[model samples]
Target: MPEITVVKVERVAGEQGQAGRVVHIERPEEWAACPECGVISTSVRQRRTTRPRDLPYGEEALHVRWHKRQFACKEALCSRKAFTESVAEIPPRARVTGRLCRAAARRVASGASVAAACREYRLGWPLTHRHFTALADAVLAEPEPVEVLGIDETRRGRARWRKNADGSWDKLERFETNFVDLSGTGGLLGQAAGRTGSAVEGWLDARGQAWKSAVQVVAIDPATCYRTAIRRALPHATIVVDHFHLIALANKAVTAVRQRVTRDQRGRRGRSVDPEWANRRRLLRARENLSQRAFTTMWNALIDHEPTGQILTAWIAKEDLRSLLACARQQQPRSVISHRLFRFFSWCAGSDIPELISLAETIEQWWPETLAFITTGITNARTEGTNRLIKDAARVAFGFRNLANQRRRVRLACTHQTINPAA
Candidate 1:
């Protein structure tokens, strides 16, 4: 049997000696190649003692006391004549083992804030952030783009800053856009400059035209910049205007009508007022939990009211709401929807409300895409889910004061499949 050597290793708490252990080893005189330079190093210039941490065993931690050596390289042209040895089992420049460092990196990437990850893993904040960044960069090197891409922008950095007692401005928010794959259910494809058309173009340029050509459908909100990019990059693919944005616009109209009626009613009741305002408020208040009789009373009041400025404004506020409800009540038969939808579509297109009219014209121009929802059944729900994920990532990273880091973290958190920590 080969002879064995045992070295006395001490487990100390915070620079003070506590408990100790004897680590068994064979061939303690072997030297490793320099990490910085690929040259093999053999000669030990001097012995430098180092106290490194290890996994805990029972109530005590396993510490490593090794003699670090400095060696001279044989290559004359090499810039480095002398270099120090590095241990593969241990992390680079870290006192802990490779496994512990990787574990810390995983926690930080898995949505734990730097401070929180530090507290839980007993790591320094700077070290955790650095490891996470390195891991994220590795992940970004490999990517898998999917077919159905959804592109959208979000407000990041707060536009308004809070004033401090020192008369300095404190930034509250920042903004960016995320290009994602709705079909494959992966994380983000790429992050953009900002919520502008140029940003979308920049992201597409980075991804290359091959990936963009594979896109069968591009879903987005009513942003012209995004639409223009989709047309330029994915000209053949259908541009689907998410149904939820339309519904949200309609909901805005509903809420606005409710508020307007409520305010107008309050104003008229000062002495005497339009009977319609009172009835409008009552119906809006009973939007939920209304009994049949109550609904009937409000409906009758609205139907009988004279059509005037107040009534016209209130009804205009609710016309989109009425059209949607009417469409929902009708059967799916083309004949029935055609008769009802065209009227609603016309009302939306030609209406005096500039915003509503614009929405209608957009729907008219993209009539095929908009009406495809009735058959194809696509919605903005997936994109919304992705947005929520981005928000959660932002929260985990403690609101990304550094925009580049924020985008990097967003890409990592969303595109997890590309992540390879060991690489």
Candidate 2:
């Protein structure tokens, strides 16, 4: 066994009190190889000295006090040249210990900002940022491809930002649009238009066709852009208009019909339909606040209206919602339910509700994708959740001054760490 020896340890002097001193090393004859020759030369030659780094331990800064000597290559035609050998415990180019690098890597990977990480590690910000970028590049170079995407949009920067009298402007504020792949629960995908077809297409282009092909379905709102993007990129993928958004559309249609009925009454010669019908519309408008009995009374009042005008249109929306619910419950392929909705849209054209006509026209224009919902029930839940986390990250960082850094921070926040610092 080799006997252990104590080498000198010293305090490092620098700009800040945060730094520690460097230590000097003393090694036995067997501890080194010849720097100028290929052999492990034990014989001493006239030597030159150099200092290099060693592994760090807490506050102690470690360094190797190197005694460099030239060595002869023995072969006459070898054209032997002198070479210098580095110590085994440290890398030739690095000043910090491997342990310190690992620690910095872990901190940055865990979402610490580069400046904060540098302060914590007693290192320069540039070093921290470099290591952080290396880690991110590694992580993003390989990603698990996702299928079954959920598309949505968020607002980026509000309408109300302005610069002061000085050249500096107030920070840009943004809201998120989330797109998630339901199968993997991966973090948000598209940041472009958030849930629209354009956004989906952008994300698909980023993911590549192999990944897009794996996407069996895309759950989205009734946004035409989303439909167009899906057809363009993932041609075979199913499209599901989210049930929640569909329900909201139904409610909106009902509201429109109610307004039309009131307008029609005003145009008539002062003879109006029963006041109770309008009351029922109010009850429906305030549906979330009404009691069960009130709801029942509203429904009964609508039933008595016997299918005409505003009441009739509202009924159509109600029935349409019901049909959608039933179809969703049936758990058929999204394509099947989509076809049924197309037929329903056609049927709506014959009805008194003018809103239905517009809705139908829009749906018909995107009918191919609209009918895709029956096969795929995916939605943007994962994307939305990830977006919330991203916003929280931005908030904690006081909003990034640079967009590139902001994007990098988003990636760090969203990605799960697979590499271990302890390793």
Per lDDT, the best of the predicted structures is 1
How many Å off is the CA of 152 in candidate 2? 3.7
Q: Candidate 1 has which clashing residue pairs, if any?
A: 156-174, 156-175, 157-173, 157-174, 157-175, 158-173, 158-174, 187-414
Write model 1 residue lDDT over 272-335, tens digit each, in one string. 2545545554534424456777767766665565432433443443454444434433436667
Stretches of candidate 1 exceeding 4 Å from the true structure: 1-49, 55-86, 91-94, 142-145, 160-174, 268-336, 346-366, 418-423
TM for candidate 1 is 0.69
Cα RMSDs, all models: 6.8, 8.8
Candidate with best TM-score: 1
lDDT string for model 2 (309-332, tens) is 555565555566446545645886
lDDT of every predicted structure (CA atoms) = 0.63, 0.60
The lDDT of model 2 is: 0.60
lDDT of 2 at 110: 82
Write down the TM-score of every candidate: 0.69, 0.58
